[model samples]
Target: MNSGKSLKEFQEKLTTSRRIVALVGAGLSVSSGLPTFRGSQGLWKNFNMIDLATPDAFYIDPGLVWQFYSWRRYNALQARPNKGHVALAKLSELDGIEYITISQNVDGLQRRAGHNKDNLYEIHGSIFELRCTSFMCNFVAKDNFKHPLTPALQGTEQEYDVKSRKRSLHEEDASISPQFKPIKELSEEELPQCPVCKDGSLLRPGVVWFGEPLPLGPIDQVDNFIEDEDVDLVLVIGTSGTVYPANSYVDRIRAKGGSVAVFNTDIDQEILDGKVSKTWGFKGDAAVLLPLTLKPLIGEL
Candidate 1:
């Protein structure tokens, strides 16, 4: 609404732009059958994402942390790539357009949707990935075959869409503290070990938790991409931008005098209008909106 430009006008602007980038978030995945926080039916109903997703919380109870992520992964696996993801991938083939993507989502749907790995940067890490925890272990992004949370994590898959509708679009707050049930008690003998170090402390899911720093390699890659590229278009789809590094990517790109286009249902108009000037904010179900709006920009999707 800021520019009041029609979708065609926006598309023309993008077509003529030399450099383009997109920063996608959880909302982009919702259409693919994933969930976002704050919906009335969100997965965090009895719990808060922050408390269960931080290093301090994991240290307090790794079992609980693992259970939460395990549940997340299970549901993520059930979802397929949606139109939004497919559209972004199509942009990769457009000529004269230097496009790059940075995603906060840990789910691997973007890649699964057919986006080029060379152009994508998964900053938060992926649930399909595991890593070694020992200080001396060099193991990174290892594939995890183990399923630790079976019973408690099973029911979530059935209610994925139901929960998404319950998520309140306006409940997100950067300052909110996440609180979840205590982790199930497990014997020290039951914990997984580090494979690379052979110390039995091998951690699972090499993601950047709530209080942890993002992967330095990918972080630096994103930094270099933004700094070196004279970007013209940035599409921020489905993220509340609540977290720091993930949230900051949009502002950083904007500071360089680039245009932004936003797609999400949860964020309020007041909040969005204040944050971006050249941004185009689309409200309502993103999954349904994406195919209709971006089909022209990205063909055959």
Candidate 2:
């Protein structure tokens, strides 16, 4: 379909729908000047994402993980939200729309753009958070400001540039940027105590990482929301839909007879063959597609 025609139809459906759920991906943040995690632009050349994100890495050396995360926190803090983020946040304020944002991205841009806490879910863990090391500790709070730690995590210094990696995917020997540092080392002095149990360690960011279970509570809540009501449509933006549980949720919504609208540069052609019925896939640059596509709807709302 032509871009103009496709955008128009998607707009029509959106304006008429009352219950809309948006499954957000890292692509949504691309225009905001941040790279998608584990993506073509997100892969770490020197270190495996598995090593950097898993419990084993943190256990083997919290300094490494903390250092890696510290850089991420600093970078995310510096980045600004683009049009897509602002558009989604605007949707939340619309009078007739019941918009629930299900974002796969760990970046907190969506929240920073002012999407309501209750209306959105960050399925992956956020970079802006730090929970207590003690699982028993209930000291969960938003943390973006912390001092740099020693022996910080390294993901290859290449995390800063978006162009070099995309242009030379095969030949790049990117190293973790040297400037990044760790937010904390979990030392006795810096660690915050659990709010519920004073002796317990404070809870950290609640993001789901590789080799870990996606938070059951949020997943279950999403499931119940999709199943109990007649959801009008699903807006999947900026995700490759490569991850398992998060990827699988799209089909669950489809099985219940919901139509999907995808905005991504990497959508699989086979999935867009209408197996899910009336599914729409807009290719290339989510920052460009999502804002233009949703503007017509958001404007009318």
Candidate 3:
């Protein structure tokens, strides 16, 4: 917990800051019952996320890849935006502040929370979007939230409770395995095909895969904001600040004399103790912390 004085200082800075950026990550969605897609918690049907989130995996087994993404799509849809997301959305709506939320999540929770589209940048492409696989075909369908995208993907969404001992026991029995295995070998004809392409090429999720480059448009927008404006404050919410490019923003903002307030469950002790200059770390569930911390901006404090 942050001291009242420290929190007041942060609130004062937030209120007076001219340009603000909220860099969001997977941690923000964890409160909404979404997985971070890391370590044991990220395992789906005993398959590693690294194996399923790559272009090579999709090339070798598009059906399996699609099935994995279909399951994720279903789960993302089922999750409601948490208070953390709502807080950022509300912040984006506030007048007289140049605010932008650069979210790495493709789950669409920020949008669902009513964040302004113009100010919200989905740096990583969204799962709800679909694009043709063929390089020559320029086909894209945005905001396609239809679950079980194809009939072949029906009932493919299986929830595995990694923490449940009983579920683990059931999964050990091969005979008792879910009836969705044989469907993994679905042929291209049974998968999502591009409507615009005459040859009917497969359509994959618009999300950026492990080896793929991020969408240029969002990247450019964020870059323009960073380059054009004198950033005054940056809210590092629910992220470890490990990944590149997005992680680099903290240093960039700090270099420009901007203050940083991190909202996460696991923040560094140095940051929490105010040992780091111009940074404040509030350790806790961001869903709970954000609403309390940003209350002043909403006239609640």
C-alpha lDDT score of every prediction, in listed order: 0.70, 0.68, 0.88
lDDT (Cα, 0-100) at 28 in candidate 1: 88
Instruction: For model 1, state the Cα shift of residue 128 in Å.
Output: 1.6
Q: Tell me the TM-score of each prediction against the true structure.
A: 0.77, 0.78, 0.92
Q: Give lDDT tens digits, candidate 1, residues 243-292.
A: 67766777777788887767777666764455546666667666666666
Candidate closest to the true structure, highest TM-score = 3
CA deviation > 4 Å runs, candidate 2 = 39-45, 143-205, 270-276
- Candidate 1 versus the native: TM-score? 0.77
Best by lDDT: 3
lDDT of 2 by residue, 188-266 (tens): 3343334576665433445666688877878888888887787888888887665676677777777777778888877
Separate clash counts for every candidate: 16, 20, 0
Weakest 10 consecutive residues, lDDT, candidate 2? 149-158
Which of the two candidates, 1 or 2, achieves a greater lDDT against the reference?
1
Cα deviation of 278, candidate 3, in Å: 0.9
For candidate 3, what is the lDDT? Answer: 0.88
lDDT score at residue 19, model 1, on the 0-100 scale: 82
Backbone-clash count (model 2): 20
